[model samples]
Target: MTGFIVPGSPEWLRLITPSKVPAILGVSRFKSQFTLWHEMAGSVAPAPVSERQQDDYDYGHAAEAAAAEYWKWKHAGWRLSRGEVQLRNPSLPFAHLATIDRRASRGRSRRVVEVKTARDLYEYGDDGSGEVPADYAAQVLTQQLISGWHDDADLVVWPQYGMPRIYKVPFNEAVAAAIVARCAAWVESLRAGTPPNLDDSITCYETVRALHPDIDDVEIEIDEGLAVDYLELDARRKEIEAAARGAKTKVLDAMGRARVAVVGDVKVADRRAGKHSIALYPATKNLSQIQEHAA
Candidate 1:
């Protein structure tokens, strides 16, 4: 009951782990609830992991150990239980499971510690405030709910640069209860063969494509209203695209030989040399400033 579960294994596929809580709550950037539902329902196979994704996973595991060591050094008195331990509560449904990165305890005071590697601190709060990403909060909350270590948890984030920072996440009983309720309902839905509605997430789109890879040489009539809506949306999209292209050309012309275009202190666009051609990437952080500057 306390060990790492092999990912993609039969048992792992049947249960909802702490990491999957984000997708269940529609907060995960990498996956959608619909995709998770189908994968767990055995309707479609999980997508094959790309080489880049595999490399990230490998780096993450290695970073976890380093993070644990850092946490131990910071809290010398606290006993750190470092391992990929899978914790489960018999009282709850088997679907509700957790595999925490580390658990810290000092004479009965126990807290969960989660290690994360981020490309930047854009999604995190650099201030000492305990603000963290919603997906990460969900994962920690699920871990606390399962482990019964509900006092508080720590999030150790190792950014691509700089030293790792620790964020203290206080437990909220209401949020934990809500998570459990939603997960239970999701499990019931999966048991009843009810899949979640589709969304525009890339994972959901990929899942749908995989579900129907073969194209049938047949025509079927869709709703007339839906068809009209699609056509109108397509026209609007093309118009917007054309306007964007014209604006981009104007910006590039203004830049001339300059590699970067900035509005005040904010960088609006930058040119990068690609294999075939030079690519212009827009930052879009201060679009209003860029627009005013352009005007």
Candidate 2:
């Protein structure tokens, strides 16, 4: 919103703004970074969200609010920031900024706390020590640089069920420095007005499609490098598919009519649900039977 990016917003993660640094910068290294850049640079329209994803997005906000209230009531000396913070250092990237979630402070010591919902807290290594996933670490570290707290932060993760987990990540100056340098480079790219390099991710494909759904009615020459790679990859994919089909056929033949065939605790039979989901080949009624029925 405005020239600054609101923390935790899709636009914030996707683009570089005066108030927030780009999370998809060099630190994250997700293939979707380029896809995010396209969104940030306004080269492509915003991605269309499906119904299920839209529902998740809506509920995520509600969950965050509930967690904020719970945290405020649960812990003593746990206080929340009244408003959000926007930080854009002159030494950092141009027209880009950093924003943080609720800054939770206890006495004179303050730390940033990011509320998260996860199916598994173990992934972040909820051992009180901050051994978080790389992406999550990058997110809060960038926030730290923007917020100027220069202290540790907390990742409060609530699983869909079971108890919540809290991981305390100390302020990582080394990580922060690298992130700042990377953000500066990304800002240069933004000023230069070019999309980041393309990758094989569906995000890149979809972004292209979203920007140019229809092709112009002109036959133009194009580079053959990608075309050659595509042809080879496509052929290899089909070959692998065929090999898979042959392997499955062998397994089915070994099973005959038996439901599940196993060898040394390894299974190679139908793995779907339902009583009739044995996944064997189906036989069709004979043409003679059809004629007889008609008569």
Candidate 3:
């Protein structure tokens, strides 16, 4: 009772997966709901994966095996199984899919084991606390709902510099139900050709730009209030930048003849040499005149 369709395939794009749950709920850091809507509606194509991004994806997949082995070694009694297994619920009105990383079983109890490779534990909580990022929690919760394994799931996160930690995630019926409802509505919106409202996230901004790449020479008047707000924000931003540059100048002046600055045990800043030379002073009209002419 498992699916054989590969992820990211044309067919897979038609169904709502656990990974897309976060986007629908507006908790995903990488993508906004608007962006997801456009992608699912086939109005805009997904961004092309970069070389470095592909390498990271490959590394994460390879790390999952090591994480699985670590999980087995850490819990000797539990049995773990992993494969290209996909699950779904035909009883649901909308198409939803889940491809879990691993499944752990002990006696009659079953747990979904999700392996994540992170550069740090900033988004996750203490070991065994069941606390993870909202997006990650949504993903696992959706998995539990689809697989019908409501037992406490194991989220094994392997940090780049530390030992792998296991966080227990217990499924909540209310949350899972909300996720399904929202997802169903989202799917209906897709079918009705109603896109989600745009948000302030960079993903949404980029998606909007990508969707309308060609610009018309015709000018259109926007809201005057919006224009005023943007101008005010831009002016404030320039002020902040100038103040930051002044502070940096003072710090560099204080650290003259020293490559690094420190206070007690805390290292402050390191002025290292780079390919491009750093300009200590701003290139103002007077500074430009001094540079062009003799002192």
Candidate 4:
């Protein structure tokens, strides 16, 4: 039997509803759970992604489809094919928290499974030991917790450039409890009508910018420490700007009339003519302005 996708299914509803325990506690490499909190509470509008990222997301779904087939055909233990999973438990503060890729059993031993795709296996590697990234680990943990299967779950890591590997994760009640606690605190903040604090990461900065694209200058004095810090940052930025102009001048002089200068990954190309002369990719320049909007 083939596993079917339930895109508009009830489970999918829970998946998108947010405040998910895994996402709240999960840490991506950037160490930003603040993004998840704001997104979950519906504070920020959806951010735009590149076509390449969209393709990767599509690839992940495709890999999941293939995984369902692999388990059913290759693993004798695989039983009753399924698609979307609704991990629900009334005992939990949140009714639903996560979804599993494909669930199977080895004869009578049933297990929930997560199908994940990555470009490199090394992304999850740690100290020569094959350790799943903490975010994924926390995700599977939440999936198992909500599934009521406890320690019964497996993670299928399908590398785009390497063979697929499976790892079994046992339930960690302490970790699960910690996740629940953090989630509860976050939910409380949401209910209290307080916005979550975001880090100084560019991701957060971009998100803020997207949320508030308009600018009408209105100044309000910030805290003394923060004001001093900003002034220091501005001073350094000016210094960098001056240095950057001089550096570019030197490079341009060396280039003379060369079309492109190749220094490792850094590319300095002539801009007087040709298709490359016109900028194909335009990026937002960082600007310092009074952002009067705050929740």
Candidate 5:
């Protein structure tokens, strides 16, 4: 709170310090595993994994697609920037990549973009037709609030593939306040070491159970006379997991709004039809070590 200050108005900055910035925007890829497992446990039928599944575990292709999409948006004359950014509240503070795209329109600069991707996209409804995925809606709303606050602006949705679709959702101070409050509650839960136990809503419980089948017993609540111990632990874990999921959804939604600008190019070092390895950074120096030295 000491250094988290803005130049002019309360909207410009959050006065994030070095120590807190990492926690806020640190790479959370690893925490996702535990969160995903926790969600699976909350499922109605709680299907624990017999043995870890591999199909969904690997997402190399998705990463590639994400990178490529960022590039395309950049090439299309969109301003793109990449790197983790910080977002905070009283309970917790966090950061994520803040992407922005600006262009000239009608002789003036215009910005309209969204934070999300094809992976985040889901389908539902009677005939699998829905205007917008509910999860995505919640996430986009959060992004809109944050963007509006710091940038003094709003964002739009530009679908990366399929039907050329675009959306414009208005943002207001009220909506931003609501989002901050929601995030504050989540942060408070984290601080207290007790994630909120949203009613074992049938949808979430079932989803968790379906994802993780290891836990033989999964329940909506803790019945003291019945299996009580496992219930407590399971619920607590699931709550934490759900919080993480919510955070991820928010961050991804933010990125989807702004185009990405990768610092370096990716070179495929190795590949085997289905899988491949790309250098994390550009290869600057030659690797002469692979050849045998004069023997």
Candidate 6:
């Protein structure tokens, strides 16, 4: 007697969910867990803040000055500088708070502070002023890890239209180290051409599928076509992987959500043409292959 596994079974779905894909590929475990931690430590939003969006918001001079003042108050006289800092391992990219702004009052100890400014602090609190974005929290933690000064980071926020807010959140060395290790592993996974399997109870694959109207009727594939398309797929995968620098769990989750949006758009286009709708697959194929096959 001979036995063969069925292709595209429920078992396959269970194995390839967004949560499982990261583990299957051994990618970005930090993103998987950080998502959970952020949810458990939620302030208000159903989803956590995204680092990519935060980075975009942190560009400019007023923002930097406000961050400086906040750190000056928080660290109490620690020297503050700008630019990147390199230590033993991977160099840390810190734009604003490069130096210590405060000195120790009683002892001979100094702490490093990071100031991140944004237009909205509503997520953090409405303390008549702005608060630091949670997205920056992870960035600061990452910086601390590279600098060997874990848990000694602070965030200073300046809302565009309100008073500035200062917060000192001690970094957890163990957690930061794990996050760095996970990120490094994720990079390796990307280099190995595998999808990172990151699991989150809150981040579901079904949510992504549901956003796409065509996902219900997605076609399964198993043939030489995949092999023919593999080279193109590899290129696209590398592009996606390249976009992962300084990305946190929330940002990656947002990208997944954006994928859902793209699928919805495709479905809408098909509906307009009175044709069969196709769900947007993950970047598993090259743009050329997609154009060819889709055409």
Steric overlap count per candidate:
0, 10, 0, 0, 32, 17
Clashing pairs in 4: none
Give me the runs in candidate 2 sitting further than 4 Å from their true place.
Answer: 1-23, 26-31, 69-75, 82-93, 122-130, 239-295
For candidate 6, lDDT tens digit of each residue in 1-295? 0232222233322221222223322343233433322222231122333886556544634466656756566555566555323333334221112222222222545345555444445423332223333445555555455555654555666666457666765778676556555655544544454542434434434333333435455666678886768778889889877774434343444555343322322311111111374233233223344465567
Q: Candidate 5 — which residues are off by over 4 angstroms?
A: 1-112, 115-131, 149-161, 201-295
Q: Candidates' lDDT values, in order? A: 0.83, 0.63, 0.81, 0.61, 0.36, 0.43
Task: List TM-score per model, in order.
Answer: 0.82, 0.67, 0.80, 0.67, 0.36, 0.40
Candidate 5 residues 20-134, lDDT tens each?
2222222221222223223322323223434333333233224333543554454465443332233333332443222223221222343324433232222110112334443
RMSD of each: 4.0, 12.1, 9.5, 10.3, 19.2, 20.4
Off by over 4 Å in 6: 1-59, 73-75, 82-110, 123-134, 197-295
- Per-residue lDDT tens digits for candidate 4, residues 1-295, read 1343353344443343222444465465543556655655566644655898789888998898776666566566567346666545677774344556666766656677778787545544422257666777777777776666775567777777667777778888998788777766776777786765777766677777766778878987779998899899999999999997786677667776765554443333332443455321111111111121111
Please give the distance, in angstroms, between residue 167's alpha carbon in candidate 6 and its true position after superposition: 1.4
Give candidate 6's TM-score. Answer: 0.40
- Model 3 alpha-carbon drift over 4 Å, by segment: 123-130, 241-295
For model 3, residues 56-172, the per-residue Cα lDDT tens digits are 789889989999999999888998886545788876779878888998899988889998887545434332234687888999999999989998888899877567888878899
- Among all windows of ten consecutive residues in candidate 5, which has the lowest summed lDDT? 119-128
Best by lDDT: 1
lDDT of 6 at 29: 26
User: Which ten contiguous residues of candidate 2 have the minimum total lDDT?
Assistant: 281-290
Report the lDDT of model 6 for residue 154: 59
Per-residue lDDT, model 5, residue 188, is: 51
Evaluation by TM-score, superior candidate among 5 and 6: 6
